[model samples]
Target: MSLPSVLLRLVASLAFATLASSLSHAQSGEPGCRPEMAGHRLPIQRVQLAKDEVRLTFVGHATFLIETPGGVKIATDYNDYVRPPVTPDIATMNKAHSTHNSRRPDPAIKQVLPGWDPAGKGAAHHDVTLGDVRVRNVPTNIRSYEGGTDYDGNSIFVFEIGDLCIAHLGHLHHPLEPGHLRALGRVDIVLFPVDGSYTLDQEGMLEVLKSLQARVMIPMHFFGGGTLNRFLARTQELWPVERREQPTITLSKAALPTKPTMIVLPGH
Candidate 1:
């Protein structure tokens, strides 16, 4: 059945609206599921990192709390609007958008870093150790917007805990140029954005993924349902897709994938 042009446009608009509304509800800390959403409840589990056991908790969107192998707590893109407002030993925020950065973090946090600042001083790059885990940040750019750069000062973070090297791509807009790739070096696992508009689209993201050649690919920033499905479909042809029962997956040096694998986690 051929659909009318007007109807197709209407459907597209409605889909975008629905996605925007769902994000709004998440930001507002509203209770209840957004339409067509599934896997909102993260099946919590524990994974061994080195000699220690780490517990991972997903706090919706890009927010995640990680208890290091040595028991130090760390959080990425901490947002209070998400349920259970996370408090961690270290928190990182990207200034690109309100959704990725917060004005204030939990009072209990030991360190808080912003990805960008007004003077373009660049996202504060730092290295710290928590128990046995080590973390570092490398500054990167978001695509230019409105004749200016939005969060061009953002940073992509690398966390080395136990035998794992995890990279978090925060609203990355451009493909990694040669220099950028060199700086990233080796990444065992990657957390990336698959939604087309805000970050790299499916094609661009695939390019980045191929460039990184990380052992495990974990997709984030997708706006639920078919958005995620499309990403999985595109990548599955090249990599095995693993549907994890929980938002948090733990790995020691042992359980890592020998072949490239894409892991999808539930987001509230």
Candidate 2:
């Protein structure tokens, strides 16, 4: 081939590669969960937190209080039954049951993200960025009381803060689909329900866990020790189960366990 023709071909190839890279970024946004917020973020209320650290408190049942490094407070399954001590900056709720959601949220909360659409048109789509954390959801269906399926009735809320992706499986009724896994991206920590009957059977939930393969797994909505113990017994061989006396734990990207571990936080 002539030297001029070779040079033209190489330039065209480079241009195509650049265009593909730009299109990928435009389609997928920044990374884990959703796009990162630009400009000045909200002031950090708690200055003690490091830039790479996040504090999580399991607040009974399926409720969890996730505090970001920027001091943004987020309460998962924010319902009236199991309330957090302080008002949360962002509240995420599901429609599986009354205990998993509240129609009237605290007026002080800056954002209230519901799992499902109230109008019943379609699944609820939320991509919210507050402070230093970005929150998004993957909608899932729930089993209705009438033995029917409530499509897009539940949501798995994923919190992207610092360098970690923490996912809360709110009232999950079945194992996740391949598309759901793709939407979740990468999850470092997972908060899940262990009650076999309420959410999913032992085998089904185990399958979900296997698919997620997160570094840290926390159990919630297990009712009592009996239910929780049953789950721990079944999975102790697969992963290490550690029962902690405290309900809150501080975690960082650099401090995560090398292997998948289940840490049971003390709560209702």
Question: Which has the greatest lDDT?
Answer: 2
Question: What's the distance in Å from true for residue 244, model 2?
Answer: 1.0
Candidate 2 lDDT score at position 40: 12
User: Each prediction's Cα lDDT score?
Assistant: 0.73, 0.89
Q: Which prediction has the highest TM-score against the true structure? A: 2
Q: Number of clashing residue pairs in every model? A: 0, 0
Q: Global CA lDDT of candidate 2, please?
A: 0.89
- Least accurate stretch of 10 residues (summed lDDT) in model 2? 33-42
> TM-scores, in order shown?
0.77, 0.82
Tens-digit lDDT track of model 1 for 29-136: 466754322233334344445573445565567766767767677777765454333346787775456778766666787877676665666456678876677877
List candidate 2 stretches off by more than 4 Å: 1-47
What is the per-residue lDDT of model 2 for residues 1-268, given as tens digits with 9 covering 90 to 100? 9999999999999999999997786566534423222101223344478989999988789999899878899999998777777789999997647899986888999999999998889999999999899999999999999999999999999999979999999999988999999999999999999999978898899999999999999999988889989988899899998888989899998999999999999986
**Position 43, candidate 1: lDDT:** 43
